[model samples]
Target: MITLNHYLFVSGALFALGLAGVVVRRNIIIIFMCLEMMLSAANLALVGFSRFRVTDGLPDYAAQSLVFFTITVAAAEVAVGLAVIVALYRTRQSVEVDTITRMRG
Candidate 1:
């Protein structure tokens, strides 16, 4: 049968993948995506723990609330990050990290 440990392991794997992406990628947009992926991994573990803990007939609204807040903030982050990328692209003519470093207002 599935267990909380199983979910935790899966989440850990996903988080590790995201971390690798963030560390290895030079592109800013890809790093942002990796950050989002890491957040999703945390959410999975939170929900899994909440579900297991609430088996005693208690409410698990906390986990749901946390996930909701995470998603809201992630959406905001993506919107702002994309805007920055767009602005950088316009100023530099390319979205690459090397070109972006030379960007000026």
Candidate 2:
């Protein structure tokens, strides 16, 4: 049978993968995707905990609410982040992090 620990383990693995991607990748778009992946992992862990934990016989709405808030923020971040990436690409024609560092504007 599946358990909370199992969910947590999976979440940890996903988070680790996202972290590795962020650390090892050079392209800004891939880094943004990794950041989203990390957010998704957090959401999964939050939902899993809300589903499995006992809360005095009450539904765990708090964690779900937090997840909702996180997703909303992440959405906004993605919109703004992609816009910035596009602008950078237009001006520099490259999405590489090292090249972007030399940007004057």
Candidate 3:
């Protein structure tokens, strides 16, 4: 039977993978994707915890509300982040981290 620990372990693994990708990858798009993955991992953990914490035979709404807000914010962040990445790519013609760093005046 699946349990809270199972959900947590999967979430931790996913977050770790995302972290490693962000740390090692050079391209902006890949890093951005990793960031999103990390966010999703966090959301999974939150939902898992809320789902497991039974109260009066009902899942907690408070934590779920927080998760809802987190998703909303993450969506906004993706929209803005993608726009910025697109603009940067157009200006520099490259998505590499080093390419962005050389933009210093």
Pick by lDDT: which candidate is best?
2
For residues 5-76, what per-residue lDDT tens digits would candidate 2 score against the true structure? 999999999999999999999999999999999999999999998998768996699999999999999999
Q: Lowest summed lDDT over 10 consecutive residues: which window, candidate 1? A: 95-104
Please give the RMSD of candidate 3 to the true structure: 1.4
Model 2: how large is the Cα RMSD against the reference? Answer: 1.3
Clashes of 3: 0
Model 1: runs farther than 4 Å from truth? 55-59, 102-104
User: Candidates 1 and 3: which is better by TM-score?
Assistant: 3
Among these predicted structures, which one has the highest TM-score? Answer: 3
Residues 1-105, model 3: lDDT tens digits = 999999999999999999999999999999999999999999999999899889999998888899899999999999999999898988888889977776542
User: What are the clashing pairs of model 2?
Assistant: none
Q: Write the per-residue lDDT of candidate 1 for residues 1-105, one digit (tens) a residue.
A: 988899999999999999999998988889889999999999999888878877469758789799999999999989999999898877777766765554347
lDDT of 1: 0.88
Which pairs clash (backbone N, Cα, C closer than 3 Å) in model 1? none
